[model samples]
Target: MADTEHSSKNVTEVSTDQQSNQSSKVEFSEEEEMLITMVYNLVGERWSLIAGRIPGRTAEEIEKYWNSRHSTSE
Candidate 1:
């Protein structure tokens, strides 16, 4: 019983780590970057609007990407 519980816990931890690693890969194509920049300049840090202008990305992802790059500049 203890072995089963411990193995289950280990499996859960590995799955969680894998999920995080998978989601952390936020790649932007050259076109996506250009559109992101255009929308950002036009809208001025309004992440949802910027993201809407560039499909295939959510507001949260846009915000995270923008903040990671430009948050220090602000």
Candidate 2:
């Protein structure tokens, strides 16, 4: 009975770990996709001008943010 309980607990723990990993993977993939779209939309065009038009954004900061976002994505 003790061994059975231990086995069951181990299985539960493994299942939980797998579920957590899967959730994190899905979130990361989604973020990566969104960032890719954002970068594509903002690259080498009027992004700096747009950012400048925004109330409190600098073009350098926007570029840096996009670069950092893209780096993390890879």
Candidate 1 local lDDT, 1-74, one digit each (tens)? 99999999999999999998877678888888888888888888788888887778998888877777677652
| Lowest summed lDDT window (length 10), candidate 1 | 65-74
Q: Which of the numbered candidates is closest to the native, going by highest lDDT?
A: 1
Residue 16 miss distance in model 2 (angstroms): 0.3
Tell me each candidate's TM-score: 0.75, 0.39
Candidate 1 Cα RMSD after full superposition onto the native fold (Å): 2.5
Candidate 2 runs further than 4 Å off: 27-74
Clashes of 2: 0
